[model samples]
Target: MRSLERHRDVAAYALGVLNEADAFRFEDHLMECPLCAARVTEFGPVSRQLMLYRRATPRAVHPLTGPGPRLLDRLLAEVALRRRAGRRRARYAVAASVVLAVAGPALAVLAGGGAGQPVRVEATDARSGVWARVTAEDRVWGGEVELRVKDAAGPRPCRLVAVGRDGTEETVTNWATPGRDARPHTLRGGTALHPDDVLRYEVRATNGETLVTLPGA
Candidate 1:
C-alpha cells in the first residue's frame, strides 16, 4: 500500500503538483525503494528541463500538416459562433441575476406604496439608472423612514446615500444592481432624525456621471 501510494505520487511530483507533505512522503519511500529511486532519477533531469522551458510558445508551422483553406474557414466560423454565443449567455446571466437581486425590494416598495403612487420611479433597463422617492414620514423621529426609488437598469454600478437634516446619514441595506426590467425600489431604515430636519436621498450611477436626486424628505 505504501509503495503504491509512493508510485502514485511520482507522477504528481514529476509534474510539480504535489504539496510539501506528499513530496516528503515520496522522498521517505524513495530512500528505501531502489527501483522507485532509479525511476525518479531518470525523470528528474527531463522534468527540470521541462519546468525551465515553461513559457508558452506559438505552434510551429509545418508544410505537410498545414490545414486546407476550406477546413480553416470552417474552423474559424465555428470559433466565431461559439464566442458570440458565450457573450450572449453572459449578458443574459447578468440581466437575470440583477433582476432577482432587486425584485424583492421593488415588490415590497410597490406593495406598501399605492399602486399608482408617483413616488416610485422605474428604470427602463438595467443599463439605465434609478432613484428612490424621498418624502417626509411621521416615523422619522423614531428612525423608521420609508424611501421609494427606482431599480437599477442592469448590473451597472449604482449607490444610494441618505442624509438627514441633523447631518446623520445611513445607507440602504441589501441593495444591489437592477435587472433588465424596469422596477420601482423601496428602502426602509431605522435612524433617528430631527423633527424639522429634512432627509435627502441620492442615487449615482458609477458607469457614467448620471446622477438622480430624490425630492427633499
Candidate 2:
C-alpha cells in the first residue's frame, strides 16, 4: 500500500536525496512511524560516508548513462528491504558486493579513515539576526561541511564560505534562501581545505554581507 512505499523511502531520505516535497512528506510520516524513523537512523552513517564521495565530484558533469547515484540509492534501499524480510545472506552479499565494486575508491577512502570525526559548532549573528549550526568533517581531499541555518528568510541568494587558517577562502556551497516558510534549512558542501586547516565558516548574502559565522573547531 501507500505506507509500504513510504517505508522504502528511508534510504533516500537518509542520503538526503529525496526531493523537497517528498522529503517533507517522509519527515511528517516519521513523526508517526517509529519503524521508518529507526531505519533512517540506521542508514545515517552509511549515508554520510557515501556523501563525501558524491560531494567531491564536480557539479557540471551529469552522466547520461551507466548506474548513477540515484541508482545506488535505490539499490541500497532494496538491499535493506530484502534483509528485513529475512532473505538469505548470500543475496545481501551479492548486492553489497555490487555496491562495493561500484563504490570502489569511495570505500577505500572510507576504510582508510579519510573522513575524520565530525566537529559541530553553533553561532548566532547579532547584527544579521541569523543563527547557524555547522558540522565539519575531514575528508582525504578536503572537508565536508553541513549547515543548519535559520531566521534569514527570503528569496535571496546566499553562499557558504570556508575560511582557511592560511588566509585563503573557498566558496563551499550556495543556494537561495527559502521564502517565508522559515523552517531551518540544511545545506551541505565540500571544500579543498582540510577540516583542521579551516578557521571558520561564514554564511553570506548575495550582496556580501555576513549572516552568521561558525568558528571551526
Each model's lDDT: 0.48, 0.69
| Local accuracy of candidate 1 as per-residue lDDT tens digits, 93-142 | 66866887777755422222221121232222244345455543433122
After superposition, the stretches of candidate 2 with alpha carbons farther than 4 Å from their true spots are 1-115
lDDT of 2: 0.69
Candidate 1 Cα misplacement greater than 4 A, ranges: 1-131, 156-159, 166-168, 172-174, 205-210
User: Cα deviation of 142 in candidate 2 (Å)?
Assistant: 0.8
True lDDT of residue 109, candidate 2: 23
Best by the lDDT measure: 2
Distance from true location, Cα of 52 in model 1, Å: 60
Per-residue CA lDDT of model 2 for 23-129, tens digit only, reads: 77766676567577456545644655554546655677663335566977886786676445444544665687788889766664222122234778888889877
Query: Which ten contiguous residues of candidate 2 have the minimum total lDDT?
Result: 108-117
RMSD of 1: 26.7
lDDT score at residue 198, model 1, on the 0-100 scale: 40
- Per-model TM against the reference: 0.33, 0.48
